[model samples]
Target: GNQSGIPYSRGFECFDERFLGKPLVYCGTLGTIPVEVGGRPSERKEIEVGDWVVMCGGRIGKDGIHGATFSSEELRTESPAQAVQIGDPLTQRKLYEFILEARDTGLFRCITDNGAGGISCSFGEMGKYSGGCECELEGAPVKYEGLQPWEVLVSEAQERMTLAVQPEQRAAFEALAKQRDVEVAFMGTFNDSGYFTVKQEGMVVASLDMNFLYEDGCPTLDMPAVWKAPTVEAPVVPETADFSEVILALLSDLNLCSREYKSRMYDGEVKGLSVVKPFVGSQADVPSDATVLRVDYKSDRGAVLAEGINPWYSDIDTYAMTTSVIDEAVRRVIAVGGDLDRIAILDNFCWPDPVESEKTPDGAFKMAQLVRSCKALYDLTTLYKTPAVSGKDSCKNDSTRGGKKISIPPTLLISAVGQMVDVNQAVTMPFKAVDDMIYVIGETKAELGASSYYRWLAEQQGAAEAIGGQVPEVNGEQALSIYRAMNGATRQELLQSATTPTKGGLALALALATVGSGKGAEVDLSAISEGAVTALFSESNSRFLVSVKPDDAAVFESLFAGLPLILIGRVNAGEVLTIHGLATLDRETMRNRFKATLQGV
Candidate 1:
């Protein structure tokens, strides 16, 4: 059972921007590995026997205790608060500087941070490289008195690092530490004892066989999975004299509305390194497809980061959901003029309990959903040539309280990062000028399964749970070609603006383009044989709504050549967007509606 209320609360809440709170946020850093560091190969963990095991930096505390075990267990009202760490940035900064110096000086053969499980995890894992290790818990520095030996062993105190220093160099390492004002303690030594041994003072405290502790301590987990396809009545989009109301409602949607209130709080330009910022446009309020940050101030070398998630698609098909998000993340990177060849992805999976039990009767089905999701992730990442370099998973995410059960939809978040040779070629997701030709760069189909359009329509018809439509499917080969062409056009400086039509599809994309520039768009949908409604709102994959200057249209079209590129509209000077025979809407009105829903959220 999920002991945490987050997934359950979010699952049960209504999907309305006005009522829904902020979603959970996951943050991580992406870094590079050089060929060598300070004239030494960076393959660390070559701990030799008789090396001193040293603990450096912050003193141990009660903070972040049971962090790893707490995450593994179900969340409850009485969950331990000690699992949350209060970090000291100043101490961490000093530690980082000292470590860099020590690394360059070749003072330590192996080093690892004291994260979850503290010395128990970091020191224990590092000890595997050597035959064994013997550490004295009494030697560790602590913030407060009266902490038990076990607490000192496992407490995840922040801003500390463990290092294995050669016995001969221990004196030099201690000298540098004293000079740099960094705290260092000689805990014990790495040896060939074949056992992980711990002591308090001169008395033995704990001992375990290295083989069992490192290898055969846990049994393999095996679960049964049985997939069953789901079916539902397809949504019927009603005909209307005008789609102005529909468009406004979509702009105000929880998933699509402006989140400037939350986003504006952060300084993306920290260190004055942001090139293509998080938001772009004349007013600088429109969200960008991806953000670019210049890492090397001396040159224009930068990196791009973009993310995609759509849990609703799992209702129709988890496979499609996973692939679609992967496509979305990669394409967003491409839209921002990122290098497709250098793009890599990270996958985060949040899932319900898939273990068979009295409380989880459909555990097998949930397990099957997880299988499909992983398979799709593998297939799509391989096909796109954008490998997943790292990932994490959270299981048993269903809540149970007061005889009520709420299971969050299987969610997969795909984050893509790519290196750029130059930041000058990046493009923002807003119109650049009037009279520029607008085009749809991919085919639109009738795949609306679990789309934002249907979700909105369902609420209007008072059938919010009746999800039935062909979930959008991605064609990896076609998408790769389109992405490559997009990159070509971007590098050649042919596109004025580029953005993908996601969630509410093309209509919303057009509305945003108009709103971003405070300009009008006169679009014609006759070129699309799928009729006005499908052309306007179908949630198709591998598509882009791009604007181009007339001078670059021929070359741009030549680059796209045989792809599904079509000239569908032109940017105009007015503030009203007109779709021939469909509807006309005020750009300001759309903008206001989009921003209003989350104004104070």
Candidate 2:
């Protein structure tokens, strides 16, 4: 171990295979610092009419030049090695410590990360609210010298922070930085000049009116959007006679399979703060709905992380797909101890370059998809009162090789974070005990337009283009009611385990719970609805499978009074999963089939 005080964490995603030839190797740095604040809303440097702009940490370098512009385009095979710079956490740690020390002294007015567009963006953002900024590029520090004026101004060097200091406190702040062995430079000044001016050697190199540059300089395009909704008949098939054959086929699909092999590469227990780690259960290898990270072990309060994405659904109805993904993410978090009131989200969009060029033939259509998806994100989040705190958009996903074009499907990743009231109240997706009653928490619908079932069926029949069904829709009001009931019931300890049917719908959810618990189930489809096919297979929105002990059934029913909930089944000790008038499948064989796709990977 390097003992660098920085933990390297990894994440695995099964969907990335749709784009890359190999598994995606992702890594991140995690750090936690105490947020020292009193009741009076934590404050930062209030940029006055006149303040000095200072840069902290490493010197500027040619490395990572045009980093922001590069990200807006597709990754080129011959990309410059200097365009992606590695981070130095140890250097960052020194700056982090010094900032805290200076922050306590109240020498700095406000501070921001020198990420992406380097100082051009950081200073511009911080000074926008004030008047504007004037930067002296000649004073900026550079690595090994010999940097052009613009290079010194826009270099996206790693591990840097920009701070605004009062004119009176500039000397004191620099002195403090020297004492802490933190490098600091005063290279710019904020003023009410209304222009972001950049000068080199006392000669103005660039000067743009702040309001125009930040606003009116960029013109909006009146884009055209053509919405062509696909039609589909959901393969009007009869109930299967032998359920095991159908169940086995569904389990073996790549999407429905287990992610244990890839997920195991991550050290979920490294900090010992995982109440419910990524994988849970008797074998400690089953997927948990949302991971609950214990924020403070001394205190019961913790945080939950959950994510949902349905790129497949985006093909037909991008707007509905966006809302459905958000709903799925929220529901998964609620399945754990997460409450709706504290839920926040991060929306990461991955789409083809929408700017029309010779290479991007249908760029306008792709751009329209991005716009619609964003509108849906705004609408759904506002409806639920859950705000999206941060987001990123990757537009350059299209690439060409040997004159052959390859592009990724329109994709959005909705990641949610919520407060867990108590770590002790955290729950998993396995049935806690035999004979516990299983309940369905929302209505099932015939929404299979972009479902994994339809995908497999289309592939099987060799008529994927001919398939179309209704995509899932979100009713924010109905979802909120269900979430409240489940979250409250979970905290009260009346529920054994809870899970929402995702990718594979109710059948897959039931199968996963059984496999994880090493238990069996007996479900009566008639209990929920008369239409067994839709009841069994439709991947509807805002539904959950909650396990309640027989003794607490009355209380559980009362907890969901007036909500759409029904007693559908019971957890059993037997090894066979039985769905009345549907399928009866063996658990072990099915579990192996589920893991087949990821075998030896």
Candidate 3:
């Protein structure tokens, strides 16, 4: 709660528990009110008989939560309840009709409906965005029936909108509103002064400097370092006969499953611009090497990608985690419909205290890894003309718990932005139909050393020592050439694509197929080499699964002549997946395993 148990008379204030050492949420403006009175007796009298009166600010207590206050206490307080009121639905509709009529008269430069915290928050934000201007509270209409000047100014009245109009347009706006039976008055003028002035009649009531009012008082924190590694059990080594089963079990693991459930919440259709909604049918959403966005009926396209390295892993292996993040982000963007050649990346770093000697060095390693990885991504993107754009960092995620301090793993969230000349040609994840050729584009190696499979499955079977190994360096030139060919190729249509990285590689690919169309796919993975199996099945970085038209195979190959684009097999017209050249399972089994693991079963 925000209320101070310690009374305000003695200069005591309630401390914000969340931001213990942070400064108080500063106060900006106090309460103020204005009203209009005048006109004829029958039709246009003072406070017109049926005219809808508009009131801006009138909230009684402190600012609302996330406003200029600390906790949720301000919203729960009972003192300001007297001033709040909601207008009748029909009356509100009539009022809006009048406002629309006034808008047709070319009266207002801008109009905004008053929401949370009434006029104070809305007006304050508007003023800040508009080069601080003075607003007169003299002619504002009130509803109190009989309220004090300050009370009238801060009452939280509903159905109010703030409008900005030039002097010459005010009369026309008023006249139009009156014609629709709505009340209108000139409350104030936009002033050049850097102060917010409130007045009653002709007397000034409250005046405050804009700078003091808008400043956020919280102090930047230098969080402490405190994290302990959890004791993990070693994984078991199954007999050769059970190897495939083990791999399948890991794929079905919930921690390695898809995130289709979470992505559906976003309203992708709001702007009527979403080409590929989050959830498709039975095919996994994972695309080839990028996710593509087609804005309109044009050929130009935009791509967005997200990637992050587990900070916990970084603590043990900084270089690997860094490389993983870069590989994953690029692959994600390219999987859908992104142009790998024109990509921009944003970096978000979350770590423990940077000032503490022990913890500072911990971050240094991750930072070094980040620099190396970023340089690699930049060089690749530059070869394709994609540049780094904007990025942000959120450090110091340390906290105290149960008498001891705990810090989150060293995590880095990286997002990539990409663009293409044509938007209509963008691809999405989901099986378009049967008989589509399934291709595994990129070189998959025997790199399961620090992979999620080894840690979660193998380690559980006393196979901890099986995880230590070096990751192979990628062939930048080959990758770049393949990307160019893909971007230049003609008649090379993509039925589906998605990135595979971190824990859910192939599983994510399958999940992506479920988005869009419900038609299931059967993929034959016998063509991929043995060494590449772990990397392909596990959530390894720098890989994509794509469905290509069989006839365009030659075009795709010619375009990616220098890259490692392996045509694995065809997407069969059925609901079963065949892998390792033998084992076969239906869509039901795949879907079941994916959902089961998520519940920790």
List the pairs of residues colliding in candidate 2.
45-109, 45-110, 232-468
- On lDDT, the leading prediction is 1
Estimate, for each residue in 307-394, the C-alpha lDDT of model 2 and write its tens digit: 8888888877789899999999999999987989999888888787777668876777887788889899999999988898877877
User: How far in Å is the alpha carbon of 519 misplaced in model 1?
Assistant: 2.5
For each candidate, the alpha-carbon lDDT, in order, equals 0.83, 0.79, 0.49
All predictions: root-mean-square deviation over Cα?
Answer: 4.7, 3.6, 12.5
Highest-TM-score candidate: 1
Q: What is the lDDT of candidate 1?
A: 0.83
Ranking by lDDT: 1, 2, 3
Error of 1 at 432 (Å): 0.4
Name the runs in model 3 displaced over 4 angstroms.
Answer: 1-244, 261-271, 282-313, 316-323, 340-345, 357-391, 417-424, 430-436, 462-477, 494-502, 506-535, 538-540, 573-575, 581-583, 597-601
The Cα error of candidate 1 at residue 474, in Å, is 0.9
> TM-scores of the models, in the given order?
0.92, 0.88, 0.59
**Residue lDDT tens for model 1, 362-439:** 989999999999999989888888989888887756554555666777778888998788899888888879999999
